[model samples]
Target: MMSKIISENKVAQVAKLIDKAKNIVIVCHIAPDGDAIGSSLGMYHFLNALDKMTTVVIPDAMPDNLLFLKGTKEILNYSKYPEFAGELIEKADLIFCLDFNALKRLGEKMEVAIASSKARKVMVDHHLDPEGFCDVTISHPEISSTSELVFRLICRMGMFDLFETDSATAIYTGMMTDTGNFTYNSNKSDMYFIIEELIKKGIDKDEIYTKVFNTNTVDKIRLNGYAVSEKLEVFPKHKAAMITLTREELNRYHYRKGDSEGLVNVPLGIENIVFSAFFREEKDFIKVSLRSRGSFPANKVASEHFNGGGHLNAAGGEFYGTMEEIKERFVKILPLYNQYL
Candidate 1:
């Protein structure tokens, strides 16, 4: 836990930053998850209520379950709207870097725009030690989710009522999924308090859970089986397990949308497995997802070596290489686990 004085000071500083800006652009990491989309849309709606000009740009399209959020339909596809994105980002008075602590993770294209923009950058996230590029950074690795912190900020600013039921639902979805429905190591009392508030706003918890987790297409099930049978590889002694799937495999399996979500968690269920990872080979990059079941800190592993950071138990990164190279690199690094396991 961070000291009260430190956390309060950080919060106050970020509030001051947001209060001063009129035009803001919000961004999350590439290949975003529930938390990324949820937090971004949550903040966007709150800012919209403030009558401030805000645009939410996602590096990639949102996953299926998360598409029910309020602003999901309006989310600007930055890759497709490059010119409009450039104009908005350039003219904005502030840039809210949410859900992700580092700007590089926003992707190569967006990073350049962020660096060139004159907007004062303000970061609101709950990730590991950040890069400290923002004028004001509100990052606490101990927090359960970015939505948790976003809601807290709104409450502190006395704008809690500005949150629409849709905003609350979206925020709740992110907070729920990122904390694994409060199953991860980061959950705290404040998380439940936020959920209670969202419930009070008439956000349907069961339906949101059903939409995000329970509903899966038939193709997704087949993809899961294919990933488990053909791609999953467990190291001797069960210290690590990995699943590698290529675009061709994805096509052959008829991988539907959001098929890869939470696939890394499959290996963590195996007894004696300290760590689990997924190597997803996309057309241009190798997306790596890392998870840990016991005392292992997967975020540290990803941040230190894989150029990424996330919750202690769950994290991800991307590497530039062929699928074989990615596997060899991950395999070679397995020996380092002796220190933790």
Candidate 2:
């Protein structure tokens, strides 16, 4: 049985809205991750199956690794085609905001357009402190992923029988990726039950795993090796590990969007290392990814210092500065989190 995380009244209201709406647009956050893409595409496929005019909009370019998912080619990028995305939002009867907590996470232009739209918005996300922007907010930070919440919501609406193979694939991808292939934030038994149901829907778990994880390019592999062998720094006193990469170094490797996907979690393999941080230099800011084991508050570090927040074990934030400056700042902040270590 699905958990009662979403109230029955809210489910009924959402179902009524879905049934009444003719044109539906599903949207996700900026720099879409697997959970964001998976939940959006999963809803797109499901809504299309219901004979609704469905559209999926993304704020920016998605990682190339996610291109293999069904219906991804049909997704409209706001950064690439703002006019069309704006038109869709304007004409949408009901908008389903998936995988993000705030409208700002949709980027400036998209957020403005969405905020100005008359469409009734429903948010389905697993994030902390959701802003009161949507008509119906289905925010549950304790949930594993937005994709899993999507699955539970579908089942709660008595639509499990209508779930198709492609939709199942999308949902499974989100659940798998968000949990790091069932490595963390996946201790619940219901997660496995949902996997069993998706498997019954004809999704090969092993193939999905291979497609997402084992499809790395040679350049990405080389980059990982170099980052680990040379760039990785371990601070044993703080039980932390960090890896910082510059734009020049990335350009040398012909770095792709998802090249550094799992690089943040590598240093946790060390015996006493409970915390890991990966900093990658972007065009104007340094992207931060944090991961920790046990009861360490990775999210606290991200939120208090780096202007970001997420789960306790896995969180991310960004720093606007040079690579050296960000690394120095991180080192300086280590003493504050000494209790967590």
Q: Provide the lowest-lDDT 10-residue window in model 1.
A: 1-10
Which residue ranges in model 1 land beyond 4 Å of their true spot? 1-6, 236-238, 303-309
Reference-based TM-score of each model: 0.92, 0.98
**lDDT, candidates in the order shown:** 0.82, 0.92
Question: Tens-digit lDDT track for model 2 on 1-341?
Answer: 54578888878889999999999999999989999999998888888989999999999999887788999999999999999999999999999999999888898889999999999999999998999999899999999899999988888898988898899999999999999999988899888988999999999888888888888899999999999999999999999999989999999999989899999999998999999999999998999999999999999999998888888989898898889898999999999988876
Which structure among the candidates has the greatest lDDT?
2
Q: Give candidate 2's TM-score.
A: 0.98
By TM-score, the best candidate is 2
Query: Pairing residues by index, what is the TM-score of model 1?
Result: 0.92
